[model samples]
Target: MTLKKPDPSTLDLSDVDWQVSTFESGGGGNCIRFGRKGEWILISDSHNPDGPPLVFTKKELEAAILGAKDGQFDHLAGLG
Candidate 1:
């Protein structure tokens, strides 16, 4: 079954439990918080909890994660 992507402006994020990695807990507020709601993955700035979040589909998020793990994004983070 395919899940419909939600409209970020219409989605209610009040009930979502956003979390940040422990490694970024002390990053001086320069990290992002992410949460999952159904098939949507939400990402928001840790410095602005009440702001609108960037939304992504489960497959999209998974691809990004896999790319990161493969060092595909390391250059963007200046790690490569």
Candidate 2:
């Protein structure tokens, strides 16, 4: 199924600095992410309008993404 675009206001741009990419994650979930020189945040289940946006600081997000790229996150790939 195709996901309808979510409302614009829901994106947490509080500290976002650049576009990472709008793509599907491990669980086949769709998310829009932003990346800084050394960081990124993958926004998931964004259609919901509650709770804090999942926050991943630069180093942490970088590790996760890098791990996936280098096959270190093979098991975790389908996770976030």
Candidate 3:
């Protein structure tokens, strides 16, 4: 079932249990961390732990995961 996308303005993430990806914890560069707030996923850069996060719905997150697995975003590495 598809869920409605939430309004980004209404989110309050003051108590999120943020976690790092296993790969990132193992000394991976370009590290990313994520947390959950209801059905939305919150992503942030590990290098800037206190920075603002990018929010994504579960569906959007799944699409991003698949795209990454398929190397659709490999070119992003060169942009750094």
Best model per TM-score: 1
TM-score of predicted model 1? 0.83
TM-score per model over all chains:
0.83, 0.40, 0.67
Sorted by TM-score, highest first, which candidate order results?
Answer: 1, 3, 2
What is candidate 2's lDDT per residue for 25-46, written digit by digit as tens?
4444444544332233444344
Whole-model lDDT, model 1:
0.84
Tens-digit lDDT track of model 1 for 1-80: 87677778788888899888677555686688899877789999888887889999878989989999999999887799
- Candidate 3: pairs in clash: none
Ranking by lDDT: 1, 3, 2
Q: Tell me the spans in candidate 2 whose CA falls farther than 4 Å from its real position.
A: 1-29, 32-42, 76-80
Q: Give the C-alpha miss distance for residue 40 in model 3, angstroms.
A: 1.0
In angstroms, how far off is 60's CA in candidate 2?
1.1
| Model 2 quality (TM-score) | 0.40
Q: Model 2 clash pairs?
A: 26-78
lDDT of each: 0.84, 0.49, 0.78
- CA lDDT, candidate 1, residue 3: 69
| Backbone collisions counted per model | 0, 1, 0
Model 3 agreement with the true structure over 1-80: per-residue lDDT tens digits: 87775664567778889887666444645578789998789898878766778888878899999998888888887632
